[model samples]
Target: MKIGFIGLGVMGARMVKRFLEAGHEVFVFNRTPEKAEFLVKLGALRAKDIPSLAEQSDVVCSCLSMPEDSIKVFLDGVIPHAKSGTICLDFSTVGVDTSRIIYQKAREKGIDYLDTPVSGGPEGVENGTLTIMVGGEKEAYERVRSLLNSLGEKIEYLGGTGSGSIAKLINQYLVAVHSIAASEAMVAGAAFGLDSEQLYKLLKLSYGQSRMLERHMEQYVLDRNFEPGGAVKYVHKDVKLANQLFEQAGLTETLGKLAENSFSQAMSIGLSDLDMSAVIKPLEDKSGVVVKK
Candidate 1:
């Protein structure tokens, strides 16, 4: 398959590599040309622009940071230039409504659009073990299943347009709330004079354990290396999207609001670039105890 890939960030770059390793001909583009350099060297053809990328590809897959970025890229760059039969798969975690709007507009141009959001972070991308949730026409998804399999260990085609985005929003909601809960739990355990490492071991044996707890506590938080897996800023944006979905569904409030605020506080204190687990820093500061090994 001739593949066009946009947004060469942490996840995007690695995904492109997976395609290349699978022997797919990939045309790559990024706002920053330098980001495409490594992939280009790995046998990807660097597209001068989105139009050039779209001109030669059957599938154009994008993994942007925000909804607005996806909108701008498709509206200004992708839609106008892509061939009529081309399929556009967006792996960005955007609002459901936003994705539906894009899907409708793409249909007008005869471009098949799928809201295909992904989870499992950069590590998952690198290992081709990410979980992909897809929403679009059934036929289009079937056509792209092999391509998706190259990028994810688990891929599901949910209902129509925006369903994948809705699923992703729900995923982010649970992740945010669980992350905050993990932080609070660790901080409270530390405050009560429990060793962080021992507590984490015990928690893993108990009902309180979660993937978030294992990734956040054991890898990043306890080690004091806050390098991003999923950055606080990105997670915060996802939480906001989830909150918007809740409001649209006529819900008054959710625990996501609290998680949203926790991420906001983390960002305000300059933890935006750190891992989402860094939300614990604020709790650590207030309690005057570091949750570390």
Candidate 2:
């Protein structure tokens, strides 16, 4: 397949590499052309602009940062210029409303747009093990399944245009809430003088074990390395959008809001580029404790 890829940031860059390694003809574009240069060296083709990329590709894929970026890229660029019958897969984690808007716009152009938001990060992209949730016309998804298999080990077609966005937000909601809880627990244990590693080990062996706890403690918090798998700013944006979904469902108050606020604090405190596990930092500062090995 001739795949036009947009946004060559951390995860996007890795996904492009996977596609290139899988032997697809990948036409790449980025807002900053420098990011595309590395891929061009590795045998991917670089399109000068969005319309040119759209013009040449059989399918278009994007892994952008936010709702506004995805909206602007599709409405102004891909949807308008891509040939009819082209299938567009968005790997960005945006809200359901943004998904609906993009889907509507692409449908009007006779292009198939799927909200195919993904998880498993750059490592997953490299390993061809990303988990993908796809929402759009079933026929479009079926047609694209074989190509998607190169990126995802688990790809679920979840029905309707915005369902994938909804599903991804729920997954993000749990991730944010678990992150907050994990941070609090680790900090509390450390503040009270329990050996942080010992407690983490015990927790892993006990019912208290959670993926976030293990991830934050083992990979980041305990090591004091906050280089992001999922960055604080991105998680902040995702949880904020997840909170909006809760509000629309008539939820009065939720842990989603708390997770949103906590991540927001992490962003404001200049930890935005750090790992999402670094949400523990503000807690550590206030408690005068660092959960470390």
Candidate 2: tens digits of C-alpha lDDT, residues 40-67:
9999999999999998988999999999
Q: Count the backbone clashes (under 3 Å) in each candidate.
A: 0, 0
TM-score per candidate, chains pooled: 0.98, 0.98
Give the Cα error of residue 58 in candidate 1, in Å: 0.6
Worst 10 contiguous positions by lDDT, candidate 2: 119-128
Candidate 2 shows a clash count of 0
Query: What lDDT, from 0 to 1, does candidate 1 have?
Result: 0.94
Clashing pairs in 1: none
Per-residue alpha-carbon lDDT of model 1 for 139-231, expressed as tens digits?
999999999999999999999999999999999999999999999999999999999999999999999999899999878999999988789
